[model samples]
Target chain A: MTFRRDRVAALAVAALTAGLLAGCSDDEPDATPTGDGPSASATGTPSPSETAPVDRSREVVDGAAPLEEIGTTTGASGSSFRGATFTFYRLDASPTSTLLVWTMTGGGGSNPQDANYLSWELYPRMVVDDTEYRVLTYSRQGEDDTEVPGAVSNPVLRLTDGTESSPQSALFPPLPDDVDEVELKSPWFDNLTLPVSRPG
Target chain B: MRTAAATLAALALTATPTVAGATEAPPLPTVEDVPVLAQTWVGNVNDDRLAVLSVHGLRRIDGGTVLYYSMGTPQDALGDRATFSAYGNGNTYVFPQGTNTLCAAAAVDAEQGLAYGALAASTPTGCLSTGIVDFATTAEDPERAPVAHVVLAEVPDDVDVVDVFVASQLVQGVPVEDGPLEPTVEEAAPAVGTGWPSVDAAEVAEADDSRSVFDLQSRVKDLSEDVTTTQDGEQQELDLDASVLFATDEARLTSRARSVIADAAEQIEAAGTSGTITVTGHTDSNASDSYNLDLSQRRARAVGRALEQRLPDGITVRTEGKGEAEPIADNGTAEGRALNRRVTITLPS
Candidate 1:
């Protein structure tokens, strides 16, 4: 089994898009991600103080999908789960089931509750071979009732497929013997490929 | 193993076990003799590589480890600022930034002018801030950022260092690192986590470090390099070059000197109360020792008396005349000499 993760920024896909736009010049304003998220704004950029030059190799020129580098877009799975960047990790296959992991992040949130609200909205889909498998799963990140000033979680969303299960469907088996990898898809993120290995 | 498991089984059968009773026992999250390290690099606004907001988690398991990070900051880069980030059990979490009036911790996190502070929503740090950036972590989204600081992850078996990360920048707990690993029977057996360390001592050291960060950025600079304040613990060190505070050898307060001193007084008051204020005057080693000492003492007394009038009650303002004894800068060059000839104020800790 072969699985190649897209080593994108550990930030939210939305922030990557915004960072893509701002990548043109390291001259980004001190504008924060918390306000509204990834602005394609002429907003003042951060001080080019110690910033390295934009590594164009990381840039997705010609309008292709974003790469692991900044300015690259996550691959699409023909669903709402397209155009976001993430690090595809984990493919745990058991005698009875499999688990897939992917995490998405964003720039700073405008408010403290934004990341929690975002986490609640994130979920993943399981695709085995060419068929889409249905299994209920939860986002890896969450929030609690908090009241502190100036807290920033580069807003992260962790994706996993470990806890999901399929009913008695032979065609859509949870851990088919011949299947090599399963694509983890989300409406809010891109499709990440992961190879499956049975638990020891 | 059977004894403990039997005890737990009995307890669970007798009454509802607390949620923590069912921790991922050792076999499931196997502990390793060798710890894991998560490398991180925080960059200046212009040259950062990763968009890591803060550390979410860091731990060592039988297989691979968990390394999590908070994803974003309000600004572009994280350089030389207080950061609200935490790491535990191989996970790293970045908290929210900015002064949150609506937050219960806002007053505390933004009071006392602590240089840098981070509170994970999961862990409540009884800290207050009054500096450039201040924040606490919420378990979930809408991360707020007030200051900036960064740390690359490393070794988790040393839970002390990990705890330091938590006390300095973490709120509570940490993120979990979940990656592709071939699950082994080795991890399924119950195991206890390593003995943790005292976070209280780490908190004190972390507080001092936070104060220094806050102090460097807290000064009022009418002229870029002339007047500045740095803090260590409860002591606020105000440095004003004698040239800027006086005319050559004159000790009478200059207009600029008075302004800077007045601002320092305000900041001193804001930090805390009922502390001693030490006013020490210094001069370049150009004159006789006796002459310089007398002059320095007179200058120190002058500043002390002036502060005595401005400062509120409870703060005991005193004078120390260290003439040519302590040279912060070189006395050879004109610039260094100017720096050496200055009035120093040390606010009580």
Candidate 2:
């Protein structure tokens, strides 16, 4: 009776080993996260929606996570050198416009970085009805338009939604009706593709 | 003290007007109508006092009459954060680098009252120590002039400024002992030497130093008779809001933009085609650096192309797009944003 029970346990162990082997794939991202904070789970198929910028006018999914993994492919990620994860977080959106936000999380270095230390020239991009529109950033609220913070971070961007003397009234291009995709991009950070129009 | 003889000579000339307004007018020393140079002050303010390092020129404004100053500091000044404040000053004023009430000590060459504006630091609250910014009025008619200027109307006609000292500390002035009314053009020049009482070397070196801003009326005492004398060249920049020129993000010139280009083309032609005509397109800080740089360049090229068609054969037209790098106004406010989105067609004189 003891020998039979031992054989049965051995069989069970063999089955578990096969299952684990079947799940193993060469494409799997590494388990260890790189960089400062908000470590990425690093364990899922790369979402297709992250390939392109978000089209907020397209029916957005309800109760979706605000964050999306952005460019490692766009050549704008720290992940190329260090295994850092770059993400875009959508905070809000208007009918045709979306407020796109982003952060670079998990890089190699453990050195302390001031929130204001990081600086980049960032702005919004959108395509509507086959015509592309670029929004001119009014300011990081510069001294005048020319002088911006030499050092800064916490990059926030949005469409110049014209509302009573806001920069949108004059500087920003009007949002198009038949919008395709809205995006925020910077050379320093990766291109942020929002989670809009989820594929079936 | 250096201007004593010049002041008396001017007084004698104005007080005793001969039939001939002669002397062919000392030839109005070439005002240059343009800011010859600008300097920024490099010092920090501490314990309610700003240390006076060497002063640097901030640039010139108001028909070359008003000079602006920037005090340089490794540490930022209270009002220094407000960079837009410079464009907002309507009646030619100075932008004290980063200062507290330290520059508020006003002084006038009792001989010529306008001298007060040069050395003193006047705040938006009229240098009154009030938390509020913005003076009650434009002409320091009530508040004396702030920092230096090449040409300022603040100098009174009949008066001659012999000396300058802190206003409250000293009670005496160069007394006007019943002089003439309509001072000659030579007499009109206000004698307010660049007043830096602390450093005797700077005081002695005032003649050659660019930091030493002479009164504007005095600077223009001799014109070579060939200066076009227009305010267009008075400031280094001539910027036009982009909204008035192009469609949202499109670099293609709108009809309205074309019209503006035509008008500007005429101005360029009139200004003389001796130097290269640089057409630069600039955008506000709304987009990424790469994107902004590309768009602005494209827009500038478009304008340059159009101007090329209209320009005279020999005028060299160069177009460059300075993304969000070159801003002339504050981007914090709407009005400032509008000012930032611009296309400037610069014709070198």
**Per-candidate RMSD vs. true structure?**
26.9, 31.4
Q: TM-scores, in order shown?
A: 0.29, 0.31
What is the C-alpha lDDT profile of model 2 across B1-349, one tens digit per residue? 1121222233234442322211111111111111112111111111111111111122122111122221211121122221111111011112111132222222223111123333322222222111212211122121111222122112333443222111111112222221111110111111111110111112222312222222210000001111111122122234555887788888988877676667667757776665687888888778788888999999999989988888887887899999878754435434346656878777674
Top-scoring candidate (DockQ): 1
Backbone steric clashes in candidate 1, count = 86
Q: For model 1, how does the per-residue alpha-carbon lDDT over B263-294 read when each residue is reduced to its tens digit?
A: 66776788775678788998877887788888
Residue B69 miss distance in model 2 (angstroms): 20
lDDT of candidate 1 at residue B103, scale 0 to 100: 11
